[model samples]
Target: MHLRQFNKAGVEAFRRFLEACRENPKEPVPVDLLESHEHTVLTSKQIVVEPREFSSRRQAADYFQDLLSPIPPDAVRKDAGIWTWLSLFYFDQICPTGNGNRKVRNDYTYIYMPDESRYFYRHLLFIAWQVKQVAPECNRLFLDSSLVTLDKLTTEVFKRLYLTRIPCLFELLDRLYWDCSNNRPAKGIVSPHKISAGDLVHRFPTRIRQLEKTYDLQSLDADQLLEILGDEFRQRAATSQSQMELSMQ
Candidate 1:
């Protein structure tokens, strides 16, 4: 289908639609919204989206990046309307029907709120697309996560405004948390128990920020970053490597 964006009225209508969905979580996507010219405006650059089941966020990001490549980055990067429309287009995958009903969340989760609000980055599709564009290498971190549920690792990392810009931080995370053997994140990276004391969700963000105050973190590579981490992180990294080695054997 050709790509279209919701106008102001369209966004308002979409919000109401979400509200209705919350009222009746099992309600199917309103097909009319897809074709309603009154609510949506055709973009100057028409791109087609062939919807399919995205196995992971990486696949979804890559699909969006390839499909939207022809359009100027600025046009789509900050375009709340297009992102919202895309979210609606892939509503099933992002917020799929489970058991008997869908679990719809806040409007910001489905709609792009570019107001620099804390929830601005929460939009499922847009954040995937954004991360793919800005930090393609870091895609490994989310390679196995569900497209529908936002995990703690994602929430904690992206919520920090500066974390995404520093490539080394992602590299460190990939080394410490990603399980290359199974092609998923290492287990318990976000666990809150004593076993996961230096976990990604709780310790990494604060430790990285502290590192920023003491070092020019932007200048450091992943190895250099690892060198400075506390013993907990290094121990975890060694364990991760050992696991990868064992899996390969």
Candidate 2:
């Protein structure tokens, strides 16, 4: 299998690791250290959660900010502005860094921006995965040019499916957007909103949930999920195209 992102599965797996950390708050979270050269082969225990997973969002945010602090400075002089921005955004969202009013959670006075907090959490998870999967090269590349590397890696992963004639995630997502757009007819013309990557990413949560309901996605693996998604995307695309043609007539 090609390099798979630690997206959903990685998120879940990291949560499991966190759950393990939460079990014992007093103890220093155990990490099985690997030699500097052996970073590519990953295990669940690489990250050592210190003190404990905090109860409050503020505490959690602070802890995470400290944990991820090393990464941003590395990316500072490099072209990894997104990496730095995302990191700063998480901590900054906890408290408004500027003159603008900050929104706080209803339950907690200082607690604000759960969404950014979660985004940062996912980033940490990605880092944890990279530490194991990419090895020493991860530190060098992830800070400066990880997105480009990841995009290339994603393309490489898709290329593998070409032998089996399978549509990759990018193709599936494109078809999904095309299939979902409402066609408007006015003055003998049709118009469809231009779907972008952001649009697709925004719609994905709802669409993926819908797909889960349609199939037993919980039981399926990544490859199986891709297969089902591709089939459904193609079907939707075909149906939409037919509908558009009929509407024109």
Candidate 3:
């Protein structure tokens, strides 16, 4: 969708609905009714990049953060035909924006940064999970599970698995069936490998205080890191915005 004018209106309408939903969780959400009237706020991805004389790359990244905060959902709804509008590779980190706003006809969301792995936004992955719970009929689901056991995987891995059938996030999860070995090295096919050449498909909770000695990731807080990164991003956006103004002048 060209960020159609109607979509911009729709985005505002969705934001209003989000606010209302938070205010009244018990209220009946007439999704069909609200969506019918909502116009898409953005008409398209023709959003001009108004860059400023950014003193540093950090300033440029900050601008993107500011730009992302105001997007409408129609640009990213399952029904609408939009994808992340701009590149995520602005600086050291992969600052996320339209990562969540892009829409696919099937309602399955795929966000991969072909440039770098750090630019991958996990929250967009989370959104698909959330939509599954709230609107399973609206979308089918898949996820790439390769990240479950690795400290790091390259951007190629994220891309290779993103559109493949085996990439569905839940495809590989299974119960441990112990059998056939007296003293085992955890032998036998624990599970069939996901992510075959055929197809590409593919959270943690907050608040669980996992034991410090636990081998798996128990708990973590990315607040400080997020804040510091957020600050850098703001500067970037400001610079970009300034540059846009200057060009216009």
| Best prediction by TM-score | 1
Superposed model 3: Cα runs more than 4 Å off:
1-6, 33-249
Residues forming the 10-long window of minimal summed lDDT in candidate 1 = 189-198
Clashes of 3: 56
lDDT of 2 at 199: 33
| TM-score versus the correct structure, for each prediction | 0.90, 0.23, 0.22
RMSD of every prediction: 2.2, 17.0, 21.1
Model 2 pairs in collision: 40-132, 40-135
| Model 1 misplaced stretches (Cα beyond 4 Å) | 180-183, 192-195
> CA lDDT of each candidate?
0.81, 0.33, 0.28
Residue range 36-125, candidate 3, lDDT tens digits: 435423333654444243332234334533443345443233322122222111111222124333211111122222234344323232
Candidate 2 lDDT, tens digit per residue, 1-249? 111112333333333433443454332222221111221222124334343433333344345445544444333222122222232223233223234433222211111122442232124223333232322221221222222112222222222322113223333333333332343211111112433322332233344556756776555544565565555445545665676577677
Preferred candidate (lDDT higher): 1 or 3: 1
Better of 2 and 3 by TM-score: 2
| Candidates 2 and 3 compared by lDDT, better number | 2
Question: Where is the poorest 10-residue window by lDDT in model 2?
Answer: 183-192
